[model samples]
Target: MEKADSCRRAAVEAVADVEPPRLYEYIESVLDRASMVPAALTLESAAAMSPEDYVFEDQDGRHCAGESETDRDRTQISEYDSERIVTHAAGVQLIYEGLRLTRSLAHDEPWTVADDDADEGDLAILAADILVARGFYLLARTDAAGKAVRTVQSFGRDQTRRAELEPETASAVGPDGADSAPDSLDANLEHDVLELAVRAGAVAVDETPSPQLLAVATDLADAAGTSFPPVTECLTDLEAKVREQSLEDSTTDRATSATDP
Candidate 1:
């Protein structure tokens, strides 16, 4: 009984860690796989469309460039052009919206009942709910894959960190026990480096920047046609310092071991 309880608790905790589907991911999935529908047929097309051919005037009355001219100032319109333009492609957008709604309903559906064991009807409903959730999950996965490609293409290699700034004119002392001179160039460099680092997934706002992150930022900046030699030099110097510190630590550890009582 204790083992079973422990297993149940662990399973619940694991499920808790799985986040719900994001709106962007859900939309992307439906759009990518949705079947193409005719331009004339839309969300309302299914019911209204008939076998009889329908004649309609072009909304923009212009037959050709110079054919229709009420006046040079007055713009001619055509009746045929009156049809609502489906900018997002109606069929796919509608299906995606439906999927989003279904996913929401499935998530909110209740499984609780008076009895511990669910009845046949309740079980069937539960199964349906599970299926809906699974379908949404699959869609989210596909969307995420598409988004990853799109994001990479637009960002052109993510560099998310700002460059470190160097102090301009040095001062002897300031109120904060440091130099009072401003480092505008260093500040701008730091901003650029940070932006690149964030794009490259090297550093995050909540996380401390590391030497590797600095290196990545430098490379990204170079690719952007921006020279950041000072930052590169600083990173190199920092790496050397780290190596020296590590060597000193190892030497001290060896000495301590040899002299131990």
Candidate 2:
């Protein structure tokens, strides 16, 4: 009875220490469901603005302007109809950076394990920590994008007219008298690449679980004159449980937020 209890405890503790897999899942979901237009435009703006301070305004009243004055009394101000595009570009970059961190972690070597006999619980804990970190990282990334999108949309919605007299405007009114921003698909592609990289990193981690190490744990338990079945079974069950719980929690939170006043 004592041995059985010990095995059960180890199994439970090991599983408890493993972090839920929902972090990656949530990030992936966001990437999948997000609006490609704004995200792409945002990324394009970030890239274009990398070397200069500029703004975008449209011919149809979607105008954005920026001004910078040198210490030598030279004032450089520019505007465009695509300010929202630029803002979205920056926002997408922020999200990409956050997602990159998780990808980096997924590729990094296990921090807690050195030898074959290391505790399974320790390994599980390390994995859990990585997942938790990823979750927070992605949440921050998505939040930044979300905030920027809202701000940009608000600005676009509030603007009543394009900067008609601004000579710096790149595009002119179309034959149909409609204004359009530059193509933003390139920026969207970059964001998509980042998201894909993140997913790939997660797949790598999931595929590379140290099965040998788990086997070693089983061997060790058997050598200690104990049954290994309970420990292994418990760890497996815990992993699934953690994943399910994390996903459920994430879904619930999203639903609640959507319904909230």
Model 1 error, position 213 (Å): 62
lDDT tens digits, residues 1-261, model 1?
A: 111122222222222332344433333343333322211111112111111112222223322211234434433223322222121112122322333333333334434544533343344343333323332332243322232234323322221211111123243556776443332222333334233222222111112234433443344444433222322234333334333433454566589999999
Clashes of 2: 14
lDDT of 2 by residue, 1-261 (tens): 221222222222222333345443433333333323222322222322223333333323332232233322422223332332333232333343333333333334345565542343344334444433333333244324343344234323322122232233355766765344321211232334333322222222222112222232233323322111233334333234323433454566589999999
Top candidate (TM-score)? 2
Off by over 4 Å in 2: 1-83, 113-261
Q: How displaced is residue 99 in candidate 1, in Å?
A: 4.7
Instruction: Supply candidate 2's per-residue lDDT for 8.
Output: 22
* Candidate 1 residue-wise lDDT at 6: 23
Instruction: List per-prediction Cα lDDT, in the order shown.
Output: 0.29, 0.32
Tell me model 1's lDDT, rounded to 2 decimals. 0.29
Off by over 4 Å in 1: 1-22, 38-40, 43-83, 87-92, 99-261
